[model samples]
Target: MKAPSTHPIKPATSIPALLKTAFVNALIALVLFSLMIGIRTEAGSSGQLTYWTRFGDLASIVAAVFGGSIVIELLRQWIGPTGAEKLVPPAVQSGISFIGRYLAPALLIFTLLVPVMFYNQRYILDLAILVLTYVMLGWGLNVVVGLAGLLDLGYVAFYAVGAYSYGLLATNFGWSFWICLPLAGILAAFWGVLLGFPVLRLRGDYLAIVTLAFGEIIRLVIINWQDLTGGPNGVSGIPRPSFFGIPLDNSDDGLAARLGIEYSPTHRIVFLFYLILALALLTNWATIRLRRLPIGRAWEALREDEVACRALGINTTTTKLTAFATGAMFGGFAGAFFATRQGFISPESFTFQESALVLAIVVLGGMGSQLGVALAALAMIGGFELFRSLESYRMLVFGMAMVLIMIWRPRGLIGHRAPTVYLTKAQAISSDLVKEGHG
Candidate 1:
């Protein structure tokens, strides 16, 4: 009787427990959604579902899952130790306790990414290659526009030079891509220096105008130089990439046939993917190396203050040339890859829009950061891919996204963090232990 009196009859309400239940339910719903997709086509006695219908069903399931997850997430507002504190997660439930924290995000990414791998389009991979190429272009141009504070509108001119250079050598002289690639970069650099010479006396908007004029001039020359550039018809059948002198075509038991891999447009695309990946990586590595060096620092200084950079005994002329040359070289690199990838070239490939996009990437990525540019490229180019189905409306949607990102994170993703800089001591220690990365 005394023990019975000590007990108070009341409903046990645990908010944290409630939240956990909601989270679990949401996860179950997501799993169910995946299962729905895996088994929907096999369902009997149901209306036939096409791709769009299945897509709609999957989307509905996803929405349901998200709705449940949101309820659990809203409970996060009560994240302290108080009347409801016990109902909340304890101390973040660190380590294994918060396993879902990491897995949930990864699952979301995989759900989105895995769909594309099966989209059965070569251009999706091509799109990846294109983004990587532009990322390289943006990084290279960041050195000039972001670091050196020089607005180069003629950046694409060097690209045209590089592409045509590769195209001509590889086709006419029968040069290998290996030899033509460096030559393309060198030729682009030479053009960069040439462009730099006259623009040395210019600055700011005036410099940009001059560079813009130069780019137009180069394109016009290419279009008019029919004797050399094949005129408006441009160059075609320029040759595809070869693997160790083995062409990736059916003619020489090219990649697919020889390797016992089915011949599809993607094999060559995959090769291009790796090649461009290597080039983008090389450009990133070189940029990082240059940043820690005196010249790289000098470029940054020039970006911050041209007068001060000059006062510090740094040659503004040489720095500007180096920036232009470096940026142009990367553009040239992209142009060469483009030429090789398409096996064709025309004035259309080198345009002000290309220059503008690259510049926007650097600006959006926060001028001096490599990772920033990469993110910007992903946002711009990748966004285009994501909305490829949008067709005509894609540009509008893309512009809106950029505006939103600028509104939210103006300094750009990762913002002026440095090509390689330290924040916390722990980060520094861990960074050394783990290798420096672009991320």
Candidate 2:
């Protein structure tokens, strides 16, 4: 055949391809970043628009996009297809597991000593409190979405109910935080059951829409029922949590005075930080324990395939309802803690954005992975704090980080799943194995 096929057919790597990708990326940056980040507007004293053009911001973003495109093109040319699957080396997997084994304890120790280490830094304590709140919320949602695969976008409604329950009970009825906490959880669980009954037949996008609508309904009811909810003004002067009978305020018989210690403003913040930490830890513990139980297994089975679960004689309705109730209970607990921390309850605080962020944390951490949830909450919430100086750009960076994480680890950061009860030896299972169905 004249040795025509002696040479291999190599794909051409053209400059035009690279340039085209670069151009497209640059154009996207221009549309998204140029007009938005490049243009800064503030309300002037005259109540008019005061514009400040930030050409440098636009230039930097464009340059970054162009450079990033070149690198991506190079990677494509050299590596070709990434393949549908990745096979991580055994050593690497073992090393990762080793590090993970110690990471949680290390984080716990660090958190425990943070108050002593940064005793005077009230900001650190406040930030810790905020992060832990999200952590608890993530774990709560994990039960419904991660375990049961319910896709609840209105989880924040339960959170709001818990918070408002505590606020109203503490302010209007003079109930203690300890008492309202459980009651709030019970009430939220009841609502969850109500929600579950309505969405029993819904799935996927339909389920999402119904949950979203439910959340908006709660917020609207709280707003229009001004006589009870205080409307948009919100309920303020909500009592703070007490240590036994001792308050952490500046009063004469408060915690500081009772303990005969020098009063410091950071004390309350530190207490709140530790309080949330304990609550988050409790959520983690409960979730982990539940994962080993019969109901938890049912939840996982339902998540993997509702049809198969029902075919196997599993009661799908009870499974879904229990998942919702359990998840809502945890959300309520976190909400009550939030009310105590803020000492205020408002309809604005329970927006769709909060639900989305909590859901994001659970998803980014790896569905049904408690440790993953904690790490994700830390990264996402702490990333926001790190970019506080960037102002509006913080959200931009946050969005980019989430996008990159999803691209790199589509399943999640720690996507490996271990079977609840092993046959021979307990082994870590690749998430890929269960992407289509149950492991």
Candidate 3:
């Protein structure tokens, strides 16, 4: 390790020293509260939200900055350096450990308990289902953003295509849900390819702008194609999911009777919970498997350095197409599931905000890290939900929070430790034998 003296603490310096400085500064900021209150007292107007008024905002900003600074200093002291230089636990192997250690048992136990839990407590069950659905979406997006390093801003379009496709197919052609489901995926995949062709040469900001435009175009089409999509009125009374051949309606021989449970509307919620939970797990497993494959390696290589990937003879075109297709497929699946859950489909549901939310999950979680994506999704999505009860100021607080988080974590929540596949330990050790002998 380089001596702390090598870069001695001065105007800018060591982490431990930084932490001590931050702690001192925070105390100073905290002591300024008396002056903040004085300013607020003078700035308070005849009719305005004290919180929204300039004085209140200054106080809040000062508090948030100083508070954030103290926390940042603590973290910096604990985990020093920056960029790729900062050490982190490996994403993939650590994800395996996390799932095998905590998530698997938690899922199994929750699955066993939710039936009883829902019977007694329904709202929590509903929230659980929503979280699971988003988790599925996040995992699917992970395949595109995390592993492939593609930035898609219009992902919600695939979702819309899936939902609307299912809605129209089932309503118009009397197709089965299963049939419509796969058909929806195929339609979305087709659109994904359609999108892939135009933006084949684009990356970074150009790619993002193109995708954002694509998403808006899809939403506009849905809005303009009023007759088919039901316009802003939305398609209601969409069919719910079913077993192999039986529906979950209030019929004589539906799921309620089979499970020996009384029929309440909540049974639909329970069914959805299990369905989404299963889908999320499936998405996770498939992504893990794909990352170990040759094509997956090509995607990661392309992500890190497209020119170098080309040098290695990997076809960038095929890699990009596959990434788009895989991500769109999952988004479509989510759309179908959402339609089934709410029994509704509307253009409003597939807005840019939804795309922004999913993209935010990918970034906040750390690019190319599956577990990080899931964790980030849960934190950000659930945090948004929690803030819902904050009334008119909710969005204000939420936006500010995002700004602060990005400032504090410029790279991401987990930074540069993206997951990847490597040789087995025995192979690694054997390869290192000569180097070890030289050392």
Candidate 4:
């Protein structure tokens, strides 16, 4: 018998094949960007529609696409289809695992020091607060999408509910932030249950469609119900959160006066920073603790295989309802904070785009991984601000970056799924072992 081959055969790289692939990609790009990029339309001095051409920019983009396609094709040929993982050295894998082990604690420590480190920088403080807001939102959605394996396209509906709940309550009844906070959450949870009842029987794309419609419906209602939601003009002059009933203003009754310290606007900013920080920490802690409980595990099981979950006698209905209610409660909490932080809110603030961004954060961060979601939120929210100077090219760069990340890490930045309960020792489970869930 002939001796077995010592190594696997590699596919031959052909110049013609590479060129062909590049040409096809470049042609597609040319067709797509021709109208979108090559032509710009605007209302001119005469108040009529005007158009201009930017063929140079269009040509440049097509060329870039051509070059990128060829480079990608060459890399694919060099690495071989099944050997992409081999590109990562064993030592690098070990280092990644090590970083993953301690990253959460390190991030928490750094986050706590943010206000002190940049105490005087108002811009940084505001940006940090924005990042933390999304972090809280991500953590809330993580419970539904990441842990419970439910796809929620109408999450912004609950967010709107919470904001409007607080806006209407505080504006009409003159309620304090502390009192409205819990009420906002309770109201959102009620809406969540209302949403959950109809969607309990649906899964996958059908569920997504229904939830999306629900979000649009809520926005429409808000727009048409001018008397209550203030129509498109939005609710304004919402009260800010006080330091336990003491305002942060320069008035004699304010916190600064009470403490015998000089009043400055920075105090309010700092207070708001720590307030959201505390709320985010509560979300993180609650989620971690919940995962060990029976209900949490049931949610996970339902995420993995609803059929198997039912076979094991799990109450899928209650499991799903609790997940929705729990997620919506945190979303409501964040919404309340948002309204108080901005002192205004409108239906425009809670849109499908917001839902998509939060969902992208959860998916890009890796489902079920809190640290991953937090890190993803920072990158996405911060990255957008980082590219603000790019203006026109900002979205192009962002889209490219997202595509590259997905290519390199399709399962997400941190794809490992740690077991809620392990026999010998707790271990990180590979993405391959985790199911993406039916719902």
lDDT of 1 by residue, 1-439 (tens): 0223444434444667665666677667767776567345433456655432365676677667756665645544433222331222344434422553465356435424532574467756777778888988888888788767788877789889999999988889989888899999999999999989987787778888999999999999999999999877888878787887888877646777788877876667777877887788789889889888889878777766777777889998898899889988988888889899998888998889988888889888876767678778888898888998999998899889889888655656545233344455312111112211110
Candidate 1 collision pairs: 16-87
Q: In candidate 2, which residue pairs get closer than 3 Å at backbone N, Cα or C atoms, i.e. clash?
A: none
> Which ranges of candidate 1 are over 4 A from the true structure?
1-120, 257-262, 419-439
Report clashes for each candidate as comma-separated counts: 1, 0, 1, 0
Query: Each model's TM-score?
Result: 0.69, 0.87, 0.76, 0.91
Q: Would you list the rank order by TM-score, best first?
A: 4, 2, 3, 1
1-439: candidate 2 lDDT, tens digit per residue: 1223444535756889888989999989889997689999999999999999999989998999999999988887665445423677778888988998899899899989988998887787788788889999999999998888888999999999999899988889999998999999999999999988988678888888999999899999999999888988888999988886688888899989878888887888888888888888898898888989999999988888888888999999998899999999999999999999998889999999999999999999999888899899999999889989999998898889889999999988889887889788877889886542221
Top candidate when judged by lDDT against the true structure:
4
| Candidate 1 lDDT score at position 211 | 91
TM-score top scorer: 4
In angstroms, the error of model 3 at 316 is 0.7
lDDT of 3 by residue, 1-439 (tens): 2334454332445667666676667567656754664354333577644542255655665667667886776665455544422333357546745654586467557665776766757777877777777777887877777777778888899989989988888777878778887788888888998999888678787888899999999999998988888888888888888875687878888987887887787777777787887777777887888888888877777776788878888899988898889888888888888888888888889899989888888777766666667667777877878899998999899889888888766545655442354465311111111110000
User: Given candidate 2, what's the lDDT at residue 48?
Assistant: 98
- Cα deviation at 138, candidate 4, in Å, is 0.4
Q: Of the candidates numbered 2 and 3, which has the greater TM-score value?
A: 2
Model 2 residue 226 CA deviation (Å) reads 1.3
